[model samples]
Target: MKEFLCTDKDFKDIAALVYNACGIVLGEHKREMVYSRLARRVREHRLKNFSEYLAYLNSNKDKEFDAFINAITTNLTSFFREPHHFEFLKHTIVPQLLNSNKVAKRVRVWSAGCSTGEEPYSLAITLADLFPSSWDVKILATDLDSNVLAKAQAGIYTAANVNGLEDKTLKKWFLKSKDGHTYKIKPKLNKNIFFKRLNLLQDWPMQGQFDLILCRNVVIYFDKETKDTLFKRYANALNNSGYLFLGHSESMGKEHSEFKNLGKTMYQKQHNARTV
Candidate 1:
């Protein structure tokens, strides 16, 4: 394979397309990253260089577009990547929701931007550990990248993916294959999770309100205006007493008043709070 070079023009073209399609803000610094990720596409198509690949992309409006986006979009994630959020879910949020008489018994959680099933599966474990099996619990795990969504739906992973998971949790939720390198999530855990491909910038087809929405570590790549718009949409999508979790580096900004910070990047809808 020859060394592929992504010229400034090719980078700009892809950056514009991505921003228009998914609201991801890619700047000059990401040129090399884009080049490396998309180089495989160039090789697969046997294009001469990035310019030829870009030309092919512009001419074709089919699965190739999805492939292009999936190639460049970042999908770095892990099971229990941010452990504190899950701790809060178990200790504080779950208890408060369970104690509430005003809230409905059914719980719906949206793991927005869940990559390769880790976040949603972790949520399933937490719910199983905390809530009764009879409780109506469902988790919607969505990502813009279709390739990752397929992997998430499969609920399979290599040893490296489950590296830090405890022995008890691993044994209880996953079945280790004969090869010893692969693990598949048990049907019990997989049952509650529904994986789908969702682009945050586009229309959301889901009709139900959710008790919690975890959009952590996703909005950091978006521009401020885009972030504000998406956060507001999430606010509308939540149940009155619902919670929203952001990445450690993300905030709702001052524009969104519907959410009140509960510290540790967790938020509760203001309307649900009792006024003294």
Candidate 2:
């Protein structure tokens, strides 16, 4: 990879571009990462420095800008990620929703930052096993990266990616490939879950008072203001007392007063005067 130096002006422009294009506020510490990943683009385009790259990101009619957003965002994911959330969803949430209302028959769970298919597929399996006879469960999975979205929609994974799972869950959720070295989701589990290209910072186009929302391990990249706005939107999108799950390392702190913490990484929307 080619190396380029990012000056203060370069940093400012790059931060603004990332935030505007993807709602990701790149902090000062990630300056080197910007230079490192994007420097290759400069070299590939044979541009001289970060300043030139900034202009290209602004002026290019091509995907130099789109490619930058794609490169800057992280897309790490796994099955049963932050596994306690799944346990909580299965043991606590599903039953509550099941007993509550007739509309509850249609369960809409979202894997909000669903990177690949793993999280939603895991949720689908849990829903299927929970409601074996019902065909009403749905998982709305979304991500910013179209590349990962395509891979996620395909629902194929190398054996190594599925390593840290109980044998039973693996067998139920994935079909062993002909090579016996890879895994793919069976259509039964794939039916209700949907994949869409979404950016959390933008106005949400889908209306959902979803029963459950899983936004794990993605917001750590955003600045505090971005996180605050996104959480507020999430609160609005959820149903009455709808459950929200965040990453194990993340929290819904003083920033938002509408959500009450049930336990680590689990939250419930409180009774708001208008919403209730």
Taking the tens digit of each residue's C-alpha lDDT, what string does model 2 give over 1-276?
546667899889888877877677688888788877787888888888889888877788376766777778787777777778888888988888778745547778888888877888878877787864653778899998777888999999999989987888777778998887998887877878899988887767887678889898888777788788778878888887888999888887864778888988899887661331
TM-score for all predictions? Answer: 0.94, 0.91
Report the error of model 2 at residue 227, Å.
2.1
TM-score of candidate 1 versus the correct structure, residues matched by position: 0.94
Residue 159 CA displacement from its true place in model 1, Å: 1.5
All candidates' lDDT scores?
0.88, 0.81
Give residue 241's error in model 1 in angstroms: 2.5
lDDT string for model 1 (1-276, tens) is 449877778788889999998999999998778878899999999988989988899889595899999997888889987899999899988887787723556888999999888999999998887777667889999999999999999999999999999999999999999989999999989888888899999999999988899998999999998988887888888888789999888887755778888888899887754321
What does the lDDT come to for candidate 2? 0.81
lDDT (Cα) of model 1: 0.88
**Count of backbone clashes for each model?**
0, 1
